[model samples]
Target chain A: MKSQRVAVLILAGLFLYLSLYTWNLRTGHLDALSNHTGLEVSSWVLRPGKWVADRATTLWKRYVFLVGLQRENERLKDEIGRLVLENADLHERDRTVNRLERLLSFDPPVHWTRKGGRVVAQRLGPAAALETVLVDQGDLSGIRPDTPVITPDGVVGRVMRVGLTASTVLLLTDPNSAIPVISQTTRTPGVAFGRGPGRDMVVEYMNVNAGLKAGEELVTSGLAGIFPKGLPVAVISSVERSDLSLFLSVHATPLIDAALLEEVLFLARTRAGEGH
Target chain B: MLGPSWWLLYTFVGVWAQHFFPGMDFLAPGLLVSLQEERRGNIIWLTVSWILLQEGMGSLFFGSTLLWYGCLILAFHLGRGLFSSTSVTLMCLLGAFLGALHFLFTLMIMRLEVMAFPFERVLFEAVLQAALTPILWWVAHQLYPRRLRSDERSV
Candidate 1:
C-alpha cells in the first residue's frame, strides 16, 4: 500500500510536468505568465522591497562610511552635472519610450504587439554562467511571448517562460542569447551572441574588412520587430575575425548589467495596439 | 518520509552557504538528498529550482543531469545492503559516489547547449560534492543519532 501511494504520487508529478510541457509549448506559457497577474503583483511587491533594500544598502555604504560615501557622491554628482545639460538623462529614457511608441503606432510589426512589465528580480552567476533571472509577472500580466526586455540603459533580454506569478528571463549574457545589432557610429551591423565565459557579446556577420572599432554604440535595427527601432544594446568591447572563420566575431559589452538587474520593464502594449 | 525540519535545514543551508561563499551552489546536493529520501514527486520542482539556481550563476542548459543523478541514486540506494552499517569504506564509497554524481550532473547542466562541448566542469563538481557530502552526512548522523540507526539506515 505504501509503495502504491508513492507510485501514485510520482505518477501525478509526471502527469503534471508532461501536461505543463505540452500546454506551454503550444501557447507560449512564458509570454502568458509575463503579462499575467503575476506581473502586476510583482510590480508592486518588488518596488517596496527594492526601495527598502536600496535604501539600506545606500545607507550602509554611504551613511556607515560617511566620509568616503560623500566623496564618491560628490564625484558622481559632478559627472551628472556635466551630462545634465546635454540632455543625457532624457536621451536615455526617451529613447526606449519613443521607440516603442513610434513603431507600434505606425504598423503592427509582424502582427505582434509589446507589453511592458517592471523587472522584479536580477540573477547572477554561480556555475557554467547561465546569466538568467526571474521576473515577477507572467501571462496574466499581459506579458507576451518573445518580448524583448530593456531598460534606460539598454537591452537586457527576452522573456523565456512565464509561470502563474513569475517568469524566467533569458539574459543577454547567456550562450543561448542572441540579438541583431548595428553600429551607430560606423553603420556596420552584425549579430550579437553571448559566450558563457564573459560579459561580452560577440557580433557575427560583419564584413571581415569593415572598419570596426571599440567604444562604438550598437542599437537594434528594427528589422526583427522583436525590438523597437534604435534601442541601445551595447558598446563594442572587442573585434575578432579568425583566419579559420569568415565571420568577424566582434564582442560588445551590454549596457545593462544583466546580473545586477533589479527590475525589467516589459514593453507589452504598443501605441498601435502593439507596445514597443 | 523526511522531516520538514531536515528539509528546512537542507534548503536554508544552500542559501546561507551561497550567501557567504560568493561562488558556490549546493542545490545539487539538496536535490540528491530529496531523491534519496524517495521524494520523487517533488523532483520536478527540485530540478526546476536547481536549473534556475544553476543558470542564475550563468550556465547553459546541459541535458541528462536528472537522468544521470537518477541513475546514481537508484544504484546507490539499491546496492546499500552490501555495505556495513558503520564502515568507513561505506562512508568513503558514498562520498565518492556522490562526488562523481554531482560532478557529472553539473557538467551536463553547464554544457547543455553545444554538442560534445569541450569543458570539464564535471570533474570539478564531482570532487567538490564527494568531499562535501560525506562531511555533511557525518554531521547529520551525529545530530540525529537514533534516526541514523533506525530502519531508514536499511536503504
Candidate 2:
C-alpha cells in the first residue's frame, strides 16, 4: 500500500514536470533558465577535473612517455635546423626573383594584416544548427563580423558574431554561407553557396555557356568585399549544364576541413585610405 | 552526514567526465543514488540537481535533462519487474539503453526545434556513450560499494 502510494506520487510529479517543460519549450522561455549561473557552476565543477587531468598528462609525459618523445624531439630539432638553413637560401632566391619581377614591372599580390587565433569551442548550438566555431579572439583582437578566416591550406570561414573575448565563425559549409568565386582555368565568375556540412558547395550564377572543367582551381573574386581577391577557396570537382535551367550546376569541395582545424588566420583588410 | 559529501564528490566527477567526454551521461551516479535511497524526497532532490547540472553543462534545450531523467526513472521502474535491482549487469545494461535513448530524445527535440541534425556525429557519440557507461558504472560501484549494495539500510 505504501509502495503504491509512492509510485502514484512519482508519476504525478513526472506529469507536472513534463507539462511545465513542454510549455516552456513552446514559449521559447526555457532559454531564460539557461543563464550564466549554470555555465559558471559547470565550469567550477569541471575545473578540478581538468586540473587532475592536466597533472596526469604531465606525469605521463614526463615520467612514462619521455623516452620516445626525447628521441622524436631531437629528430624534430635536427629537421628544424636543416629547414632554417634552407629558409635562408630561399630568402636570397626570393630577393633575386622579386628584383627580376620589379624589373619586369609585374604587379605584386595584395597584402593584408593577419592575426592568428585558436579555436576555443565548436558547434555551439544544437545538432541541427549552423556550422559555427568560436575562436579565442574578439573585438579586442580587432576581429569583426565578415572578416575572412583562412588556414595555410585554403579558406576556412568568416567571422559571423563577435563577443567580448570570443567570436563565432560561420564555416563555408554552412547552408547560409555564400561567397563570390572565379574559376582559374575558364575565368568564369560565379557564387559558391554551401549545401550543408560534409557536402560540397554548389557554384551557381555561372553562365551556361561558361566552359568549366573538373580539377580547375577556384579563387575568391573579391567582388563581395569580404574575402580578398585570389585566395584559394576550393578546387572545382564537377560541372554540369541543365537544358531546363539557365545557370550551370557546378560543385566544388572546400579546401579547408573546418572540423580538423585547430587554429586559423583572420585576414583584416586595411582600407586604401588607412596607412599600414 | 556523509550523503552530502558523496553527492558533492559524484557531482564533481560527473561534470568532469562530461567535460572530457561530451554526450556521456554522467547522471548514472544520480540514478544509483535514487535507486538506493528509494525515498520519494531523495529521488526528487537527486533528479532535480542532476537536471540542473546537465542543463548547465550541455548546449541543448533547457528541459532536456529533465525529460531524460523522467524517461530513465520510468525505465528503472519497468526494469525492476524483470531484473534484480542489485545486479551490476542490469545497471550496466540500463545505462547503455539510457545513453542511446538520450541521443534519440535529443535528436527528436532538436528536430522539433528546427535544428540541423548531424546524424553521423551524433550517432557516433551515442555509440561511444553507450559503450562508456558500463565502465563508468563499474568505477562508481567501486567508489561507493556500500551505497550501491542491495542490502536494506537506513538513510
Candidate 3:
C-alpha cells in the first residue's frame, strides 16, 4: 500500500509538471514573470556588489598605484595634442562628404546613438548556459533586444534580453550568435556563425571563388537589420576550398575578446535627418 | 523570521558566488539543507524562488529549472528510503547524480528550444557541480542555526 502511494504520487506530479511546462511554452507568461521579478532582483543585488568592488579597486589604485602616474599623464597629453590636429582634418573631410552627398542627391545616412554601459557579470548560475554577459543598462536605458553592442575595438554582441535596469548580451562567440558580414577589401559577403566560446567563428555560404584571404577584416553588411553597416566584426583567420561543398570553408577571429570586456557601447539607430 | 532571514542571506551570497563561478549552481545545496530540516514550507518556498531566479537568469526555457528541482526532490525522497538522510556518502552520490543530470537536462532543453549550446563547457560544469555539491552541502549544513534544527523542535 505504501509503495503504491509513492508511485501514484510520482505519476501525478509528472503529469502536473508536464501540463505546466506545455502551457508555459505556448504562452510565455511564466518566462516574463521570471524575467521581471527574478532577473530584476538579481540585477539589484549585482549592481550594488559590483559598485562596491569597483570603488574598492579604484580607491586602492588611486592611493597606492602612483609610481608612473606622472609619466602616463605626460604621454597622454602628447597623444591628445596629436588627436586634436587629426580631428580638425577629419572635420574638413566630413564637410566635403556632406557637400558631395547633397550634390548627388543621396539619401541621408542612418544615425546610431551610442550609450555606454558597464559589465556587471558573465554567465551567472546554472541557467546561464550560453556565453553571455550582464550589463548595467536595460529597457529603461533605451536598450531593447537586438541592440548592437560594441566597443572601440570591434563588435561585442547584441542585447538578448532586457529587464528594467539590466540586460543580457549574447556574446559573438556563442554558438547561437550569427551575423551577416562582408570582406573589407574583396566585398565578398558571408554569414558568420559562432562555434562556441574560445573558438573562432566560421563564415559560411561564401562562393568558393570569392577573393577572401587570411587576415582580411570582416564588417557588418547591415543585411540582418540588427547590426549597422561597416562596423568591424572579425578578422579572417583561415580560408580553404571544400571539395564537397560549393562554399569556401572559412574561419575568422572576433576582434574583441568577450571575457575581457569591461564596458560596451549600445548602438541605437535613429533617422539621420532628425539631427543629433 | 529567522528562517526567512537566513535564506535571504544565503540567496544574496549565492548570487555573488554564481557570478564569480559562472555555469554553476551554488544555491543547490540549500535545498538539501531545507529538506533535512523537514521544513515543508521552506522547501516549497526555496524551490519556487530558485526556479524563478534561475529561469530568468538563464538562457534556457522556464521549465528547465522546475524539472531540475523536481528531480532533486524525487531523488531525496528515494534516497531517504535507503540511507541516512544526513550521510556524507549519500550527499556525494546525490551531487554526482545532479552533475550528470545537469548535462543531460541542459542538452535536452537546449535542443528542444532550438538553441545552440556549448556541450564541452556544460560538461565541465557538470564535473565541477559533482565535486562541489558535497562540499557546499557540508558548509551549508554546518552553518544551519542550531535553534532552527528540526531535531530541536518539541513535538
Candidate 4:
C-alpha cells in the first residue's frame, strides 16, 4: 500500500509539473498575477520596516556620521561664495548672448517634463543579470517603461518594468543594456553595450580607424528615441583594436555611480498636443 | 493552538525574509510543519503556498518552483525508509542538495546559456541556503506553539 501511495504521489507531482510548464509557456498570466500580488504584498510589508530603517539611518547620519560633515559644509560654503560671484559675471555675459541670439532669431531648445522619485529597492543578485532598481513612483506619477531615469550628474538608466505603485529601472551597466552614443570630441558614433555589473562598458561596432581617444566624452546620439540627445552616458577609458574582430574594442566608464543612487529624476515625455 | 492569525504572520515573515535575503530558505518552517503534522492536506496546502511565494518573488521564468517542490516531495518519499522523517540533519542535507538542484534545474529549464549565467554566484547562494536551512529549522522548532508541539509528540 505504501509503495502504491508513493507511485501515486509521483504521478500526481509529474502531472502538476507538466501542467505548470505548459501553462507557463502558453499564457504569461502567472507572471502578471505574481507581479501584481507580489508587489502589493511586498510594499505593504516593507512600509513599516522602511520607516524604521530610515529613522535609524537618519540618526546615524546626523549624530555618528557628522564628524566630517562640518568641514565639508564649510568647504561648500566657500565654494558657493565663489560661484555666486562667477554667476553674476556670467549673468552679464548671458544677457549679451541673449541679445545676440534674439538679433539672430535662434530658437530655444526643447524642454522635457520631469518628475522626481525615491529609489525603494534594488535587484542585486545572481538571479538578475540585468541590474535593476525599483523606484517608488509608477504609472500614477506618469512613469512609463522606457522613460529616461537620470540624476544631476548624468544619465542613470531607463525604466524597464512598471507596477502600480513602483517601477524597475534597468541600469546602464546591465548586460542587456545598449545605448547609441557618440564621442563628444571625435563626433564618431558607436553603440555602447554593458559588459556586466561593475565592469567598464564596451563601445562596439566602431571602426578600428576611428582614432577614438581615451578621455573623450560619450553622449546620447539622439538616434535612439529612448534617451534625449547629448545626455552624458560615459567617458571613454580605453580604446584598442582587436586583431581578430573587425570592430574596435573600446571601453568607457559610466558617469553615474549606480550604487550611491538614492533618488532619481524621471523624464516623462509630454504628448505632442500638450502645452509646455 | 496556533490560530490562522499566527500562520498568516508566519507566512508574512517568511515572504518578507525570502524577499530581502534571496538565498535563505524561509520555507523550511512550512516544510517542518507539514512533516510534523503528517497530514496529506497540510502537505498539499503548504506546498502550494510555498510554490506561490517562490514564484512570486523569483525573477526567473515561471514553473521553477513547481519543479522544485515536485523534486522535493519525490525526494522526501524516496528517502522515507532511509532515515526518520523527523530527522533535522536529514532535512538540512536535503535542503542543501535540493537548493543546488533547483538552481541547476531552473537554469536548464529556462534555456539560459551556460556562458551567460552567473554560475559561481548562484552556486555560492545555493550552498549558503543549504547551510542556513538547519539554523532556520531549529528556530522554527523552538518557536512552534505548545499545542502543536503536543500534537506532534502524540503523532
Point to the candidate with the largest lDDT: 3
Q: Model 3: per-residue lDDT, tens digit, A1-276?
A: 999998999899989988887898899788778877778788888988888996787566444434434456777855764565457557856975664444334221368777778888888888788888988898789888899888767889998878888888999888889999999999999999888877899999988999889999999998988888888899999999977899999999999888888767888878662343
Residue lDDT tens for model 4, A36-140: 555445555555777889777756644543454446667785576456546755885797566444423422125566777777656622233346776788767
RMSD of 2: 8.6
Query: Measured against the native two-chain assembly using Cα atoms, what DockQ does each of the candidate structures obtain, in the order listed?
Result: 0.18, 0.28, 0.70, 0.25
Model 1 residue A87 distance off true place after TM-score fit, in angstroms: 28
TM-score of 1: 0.61
Deviating ranges (above 4 Å) for candidate 3: A59-111, A271-276
Give one digit per residue, the lDDT tens place, for model 2 in B14-118. Answer: 666554454567666457645655467767777776666556445545776676777777777777778876577777777778768767877777776665566
Candidates 1 and 4, the one with greater DockQ: 4
Please list the residue runs of candidate 2 whose C-alpha ends up more than 4 Å from where it truly belongs after superposition: A1-28, A42-236, A242-250, A259-276, B1-5, B37-46, B145-155
Query: Which tens-of-lDDT digit does each residue in A70-96 have in candidate 1?
Result: 466687865655455346447746975
**TM-score for chain B considered on its own, for each of the candidates:** 0.58, 0.86, 0.97, 0.82
Which 10-residue window of candidate 2 chain A scores lowest in summed lDDT?
A100-109
lDDT of 1 by residue, B82-116 (tens): 86544456556767876665555545544443433
- Is model 2 an incorrect, acceptable, medium or high docking prediction? acceptable
**C-alpha TM-scores of all predictions:** 0.61, 0.60, 0.86, 0.75
Error of 3 at A222 (Å): 1.7
How many collisions between residues are there in candidate 2? 3
Q: Can you give the lDDT of residue A112 in candidate 2?
A: 67
Q: Report lDDT per candidate.
A: 0.57, 0.69, 0.85, 0.69
